[model samples]
Target: AEIGQVDGLLQDFPANNQAFRDANFDIEQLRKDIDQSE
Candidate 1:
């Protein structure tokens, strides 16, 4: 649910946007950590 909202926000940025890329990377890492925790 929260991840979906974050993905939607990421989509709102242009493909070339650096911040969006960084955020995507961070989100990917976060997902990995969450999966590992479970």
Candidate 2:
């Protein structure tokens, strides 16, 4: 069961990583827009 849980986490890692990257990109874009507005 523990091994299965680890495998499940491994399978989810890529999606989680992608989401994190997308969030960071959105944050960066928002910062840039705010800077431009200032």
Candidate 3:
């Protein structure tokens, strides 16, 4: 996705927000990035 698309998603999707509620994280794209790296 383009930066614009990601930025838009971050703006619209509450789950996509990077704000930390606790020590845990969203882990939404972690698998995707890890797969690509592998």
- How do the residues 1-38 of candidate 2 rate in per-residue lDDT, one tens digit apiece? 69999999999999999999999999999999999999
Q: Distance from true position, residue 27, model 1, in Å?
A: 0.3
Question: Which residue pairs collide in model 1, if any?
Answer: none
lDDT per residue as tens, model 1, 1-38:
69999898779767659878899999999999999999
Worst 10 residues of 2 by lDDT: 1-10
Candidate of highest TM-score: 2
lDDT of each: 0.88, 0.99, 0.65
Model 3, span 1-38: residue lDDT tens: 99999998877777534344322343646766788999
Evaluated against the true structure, the overall lDDT of model 3 is 0.65
For candidate 1, give the lDDT of residue 1.
64
lDDT against true structure, model 2: 0.99
Q: Residue 31 of candidate 1: its Cα lDDT? A: 100
Q: Candidate 2: misplaced stretches above 4 Å?
A: none
Q: Candidate 3: minimum summed lDDT over ten consecutive residues — where?
A: 16-25
C-alpha lDDT of residue 34 in model 2: 100
* Selected candidate, larger TM-score, 2 vs 3: 2
